[model samples]
Target: MRTKNFVLILLSSLSVLTFLDRNAISIAGHRITEELHLSESQFGWILTAFTLSYGLLEIPMGLWGDRSGEKRIITRIVATWSLLTALTGLATGFVSLFATRFIFGAGEAGAYPNTAIAIRKWFPLQERAKAQAFVWMASRLGGALAPLLIVPLQMQFGWRVTFFVLGGVGLAWVLVWHRLYPSESPLQDNTDQQQYVAPENDAPRWTVHLKDRNFWFLLVMYYCYACGVFFFISWLPKYLQAGRMIAEKDLSYSAALPFLLAAGGCLLGGWLSDHLVSRIGLNWGRKLVPVVGLSLSALLMLGCVAVDSNVAAVIMLALGLATMDVTAPVSWAIAIELAGKASGAVTGAMNTAGLLGGTIASLGVGYLISWTGSYDVPLIILAIQLLIGAFFASQLKVSTPRALDKT
Candidate 1:
């Protein structure tokens, strides 16, 4: 097998473990809340703790990957987060859980940004979006699997044991990755890989992106989009149970449906974007998916809120996430296109914005639920954010990264 394909498989596997570990808390949220005797507002703070630290550290970790190399940095990231994931099972109160999740966020920071750097290194420009799709698809698969796997395990062995099992799974991946990742550059066909060197005097500074209007637009768009995404990640299970009156036994299937469809969305979006790019051009090809997808997703989210039947609400919510995710890979591809050699730092900045959005969603949803006495209010707010994101997506003006222009 080709080395790049092998590396992609490894990275995709890591993406699976990343979301599985990340989503476990949300899956086990009810039990955790009950056992800890935490209020909804406190629960929101716990979730926010992760996003806050994750956002704060994203750029630094991404810059670390760009300056050094992804292999070592990603290894450190997985190990630290895996250890923290296990330690989360030990928390006795709200403060302990909050601290563990915050530190876990720091450990998990830059994972995707580093993955973006690796994709830029190993895949040709045309293949990058598909590669990103596979990775993201795996993440959705992980999210889907969380309730399926965690519910049963936590029921049998307890939620804490479920986390221990997840932590062990991640550590095993770390060992496999260390052994399998290519020791040298894998692809010679990609000009970007061969031509871009980090130390060149004209190599674009990370700060240079600050001057680009497109960068700000990308950041804002992702910021708004992430609120929708993180709502699924951090709040969906609780919402399904408490807000929608989904029975506990049925939680796994109901919660898994959106992510299952979202996995497909990633694949469809990647293929559609690549095909569009071939038919037209990069600017429109990339822009079209997010604009159309997010608009539709927003409407569907409102439908989820408006529906009276539980089954109809579930379908609408599932479709909403699926449509929103259709833009995920193409958005990452745009970041890669914009940054080239600085892909790590640029994607990091974009994701920092995303995590900040997630931070707000995680905390705000809890408050909204408490204040409004319904989950509908938070969903409405998120849908509005998606509409704004679609507007920003439409406004993005694509240009070659300064680093690539120099080359």
Candidate 2:
């Protein structure tokens, strides 16, 4: 239990570093834009570069995690993304920065899917949601904490040096992850007695997974969700400076408000989902939380557009993000459970689709802003996607074996 908890902490820390490194660009977006002599649309293209690559590669990397050991793949991914992030410091032009960031996104594409596979490997059914929540919260916490850390660092060092330092931190984590993770699954460990008692299998093939209807539905839900999230990740800083006319100092902490709230939602959702599942059973556990979460999320999203002040807008955004996060753990939890021994592969596919959604949302929102010259217009579009997400999540059919319901 202690070691598993340690592993969780490490996973969470890495996620924090990932968000910190990525979001650092947002914190420095104003300066970067001026330094590079960039047009607003060109800046959008910079983010699109990363989003496009990240979305395209999520599934392939996730599948690799499923087939190759999660520990190994995750460690390598951390190393790879960190290296690319560091290279971002060396970029002198929009094209150079875009390429580096895009490559960084590709390396990061499988992080959550791999984390899902790790949870499936290490945690029991009863604890999976909490474990996933821990994972999700850590990532959010990283984002929340970024302004505190990265903003100060960027101020002290130039923004470029900040990226280099953040990248170095990731390299350190890779060493630790590689050291801690065992070569084989913990279930297969001779020291442990818990047998997952593997589900009955019929000569495993990728085709069996590819044919499932539930899988596609989940994919659709994730894609929609990703669109909303990517919008936040890509546009929040600009939104603060442009949309709200916030000062850089306030922008640092205020930008984090939504993420801080989201951290709580991530934990709350995970803990609640697991408890509900344990009490009710898989069908109810799997379906109930997501339906309610996505529905409420849609309402809150629409609320985000209605707010007049930056304070109100971000607070509403926080609530909207929290409501959506309420189902996040369950989403990944279902993917791993349904995947069984193939957790990595299925999770990867779901994430891949989500990334595509993120890519579309990122680019689409930018174009909306460019065309309409108002953040609210693009945000309205995002709200509509959330509505669709709610519908998809409500109708989702998660396939878990009846016998495993109590597990």
Candidate 3:
């Protein structure tokens, strides 16, 4: 493989690893609840712990990536997070588990921004969206692979072993990454061919980026979208089992179907965005990909809420998630574009905002379902949020092209 593409694949594998670690808890949720003697609230907290820290640390980690080499930043990320994942296996109670998950989130927080930075360094502008999409799709594939592989592993060896096994994979990835990756430059010949790697400009500090209305718009957009997507990830299997009357054994197959579809959607999203940009222009392409995806998914989500049968509901969900994926790459690519060289800080902040919404959805949606006696209410609420998110996404200006400018 070419050095550029090889790096992309390695980075994509890191995307896979992060999701594998993130979703491992969901796969083990049932057993963990039983063993901990926990309520639904506590189960929600288990998920929340990871997201809260992960979201909170996103900007800092991202800034770290932009300033430092992605090689060292990613190495640190994989090592620390892999250790946290292993520690999660050994947790004795709620506090221990929550702490480990939070630390795990902190450790893993830098992965995406670092991946974004790496793509910026390696890929030409023409392929960036497709590149982002491949990484996102790989992550989804990891999510899809989790239930299929981890659940069965949990059955055979126990949940703890499942976690340890996954952690081992991350550790192995770190060693391979450290050995194989070259120190690639972030810029090429920009002005009159005078070029070498320069230090990242300090202009995109948190305070400055946070103050921008456009930044906040993207933040809100991601948050609303994350809420619904996470609601499904955290609760979908239970919904399938409880509301849809899908059998316990069948839940695995049914639950995985949407994620598999989600992987396909992610691939389609990146390709479509690139195509749209090439055919029309960047601004319209970026805006329409997400706007269309979210709007289409919103309608599907409303239908999902109203549908009665398991078969039909699952179909609607599959379509909804696939449509949602279409905008996934744009959400990421634009963050870096807008932030310029400080893509790390902006991307992290943007992701952190989304995770805040997701964390709330994970906990609140659970309680809402408990009180309301159905997943329908929370989903209707989420569908509305998706539309709001779509509105925000539609307002983006790809013509700005801040990424191309000197800071």
Candidate 4:
């Protein structure tokens, strides 16, 4: 096979491992809480620790990838996080678990942003969104797989052992990646000339993005969107058990359903966005999916809450997550378009905003559950956030950068 295709496969594998390790904690959350004697609010703090450190380190890690190279940085990230993932199995209590996950987040912070940089380097403009879709689709595949794998493994061997196995899986991926990934970026002979690749001296300064109104709009849009999407990652298993009253035996399938549909949504969104870009142009093409998808998802979230039947609620919740995910690949594509040569830094900033939103959702859900004693309110609030994101996505004014003009 071609070298770029091989790179894409490796990158997609990394995406899968990233989410598998991430979702394992939530899948085993109930077991962990029971074993460790933790409260709802305390568990939220554990989740928050990861996101806070992850957000804090995202830009710095992305900048490292930008200045140095993604291959070296990504290798380090996976190795550190994988070791931390193993150490999580050894946590004695809340404090130890919190510290381990926080450092793990810092280790894993720049993963996708660096993957974005790799995509920018290896794929052409037209293919980038589809490439991003495949990567994200792999992540959802991991999410879907996590509950199926973790529930059984934890049931048999225990939660701690499940983490150790996952950590080993990540280390295995790192070794393969180090061995097979090209030392330099693959030739981009077929890449779009209209795409900007600024020289070392001419690269856009970080301050330039600060002045771009569209950049701020993108940040706000992603922040709101993350608040909604993170529910699947951080709380879905607990919600399935406590809120919907799903049995432990049924939890894996129920939780897996949403991510399976989300994988399809990523593909549909990427294909639709690319088709629209060909027909309408960049601004409207990129704008429409996020606006429509998020708006529809907000309504589905409300429907999930209003429905009386547990089955109906699960279906609605699954569809809501799937619809919201339809915006994921398109959003990354827009970040690349706006980034000039700073794909790593720009995507990093966007994801940092997302991690902040995820942090809020993780913490807020725990505290709100304690206060109100219902998960429904948090779902409603998240729906509102999605609506807010759709509004910002509508207002975004996207244009091809002037730097691309000369090419």
Q: Count clashing residue pairs per candidate.
A: 0, 0, 0, 0
Clashing pairs in 3: none
Best-matching candidate per lDDT: 1
Task: Give candidate 4 misplaced runs (Cα > 4 Å).
Answer: 186-203, 403-407
lDDT of 4 by residue, 60-88 (tens): 88889988899999999999999999999
TM-score of each: 0.96, 0.93, 0.92, 0.95
What's the lDDT for residue 147 in model 4? 93
lDDT of 1 by residue, 1-407 (tens): 38788888999999999999989999999999999999999999999999999999999999999988899999999999999999999999998999999999999999999999898877766777899999999999999999999999999988899989999998999999888898566442334554433222234766777887889999999998899999999999999999988988899999999999999998888888888888888889888999999999999999988889999999999999999998889889999888877889999999999999999999999999998899999999999999999999999876556434432
lDDT of each: 0.90, 0.77, 0.81, 0.88
Which ten contiguous residues of candidate 1 have the minimum total lDDT?
A: 194-203
Candidate scoring better on TM-score of 2 and 3: 2
Candidate structures ordered by lDDT, highest first = 1, 4, 3, 2
* Candidate 1 Cα lDDT to native: 0.90
Per-residue lDDT over 173-213 for candidate 2, one digit per residue giving the tens place of the 0 to 100 score: 89988988656555543334545433423224444766667
* TM-score of candidate 4 versus the correct structure, residues matched by position: 0.95
Residue 191 lDDT, candidate 1, scale 0-100: 40
TM-score of 1: 0.96
